[model samples]
Target chain A: DAGVTQSPTHLIKTRGQHVTLRCSPISGHKSVSWYQQVLGQGPQFIFQYYEKEERGRGNFPDRFSARQFPNYSSELNVNALLLGDSALYLCASSQGRTQYFGPGTRLLVL
Target chain B: GQQVMQIPQYQHVQEGEDFTTYCNSSTTLSNIQWYKQRPGGHPVFLIQLVKSGEVKKQKRLTFQFGEAKKNSSLHITATQTTDVGTYFCAGHGDNNDMRFGAGTRLTVKP
Candidate 1:
């Protein structure tokens, strides 16, 4: 079966702009989580959704938000982007407790 | 808030040498997960340790969970160039919120 898939392999945005990243979970998976990975650092959890409901959230600012759809697909939206927001955004899907990650969307803010 | 810290921010070893990375969490974890991320790539799950003091091995890699469930370790035996990457440990707390360590980047000289 195909693994998790993300859209818009990359993006370039300016400060104060908004961007949306999309993720499609693996088939039969009901949990999707979003993470932000800065250069030379591990991923930081942003939000997690299970069965189309908000399950958990991390210490990210209000500018970052995410939601899962009925089909288990997820979208991460960041508003008023700052240069600090430039990083890789990854989406992961879990069936039980183990998660499978996507290729991730690289975002750059100027 | 739960925090996960990894030691030895970076490691460089000659081929066939052994390497180990340690992870500690401020709070007891429900489970710990290991992931490998190649340069410019996304994280891929390696293994998950749910029970305290559990040990699991895969090929040249061995993973151990501490008896207190607040620390873990990943050891690579006879490191190969293929093992060059950043290894991350993520801790899941009782709320199911996951926090990832800064990661240990491994470089193997072939």
Candidate 2:
């Protein structure tokens, strides 16, 4: 089966611009979560969605938001991007406990 | 808020040496998951421990959950160059959200 997939492998944005990252969960998965991974650091949770509803959110600022679709795909939106937002955005899908992560969307704010 | 902390930010050992990383949570965890992220790669699930005092082994790696369910450890026996990467311990909190530690980066010298 195909694993979690993400779009726009790389992105370049400017400060104060808005960006959106997409994620397609694996088949048969209903839960999708977003995380941000900075260089030399572990991933930090951003948001989690299930059944098209918001389930959990991390300590990120209000500028970050996410939603899941009926098909279990997800999109993470960040507004007013900052240089600090330059990192890998990962999407993970899970049914129970184990989560499988996507290759991630690399975002750079210039 | 729940937080997970890892010790020994980095380790460098000979290819045949053993290495271990520790994870501690400020609150009891519903479950703990381990992941390995290669350089410039997304995190890949390694294993999950759900029960207190549980132990699981995968080839040269052994995982142990503390009796209190608030700490965990991952030990690699006879480390190989292939084991080089960041080892992250994610503690499940808030039902659907997982908090990841800063991670322990392992470097093996041939």
- DockQ winner: 1
Model 2's CAPRI class is high
Which pairs of residues have clashing backbones in candidate 1?
Answer: none
Candidate 1 C-alpha lDDT tens digits along B1-110: 88899999999999999999999999989899999999989999999999999999999999999999999999999999999999999988555667999999999999
* lDDT, residue A67, model 2: 84
DockQ of each: 0.83, 0.81
lDDT of 2 by residue, B28-83 (tens): 99889999999989999999999999999999999999999999999999999999
**What's the lDDT for candidate 2?**
0.95
Q: Which stretches of candidate 2 lie over 4 Å from their true place?
A: none
Query: What is the Cα-based lDDT of residue A100 in candidate 2?
Result: 96
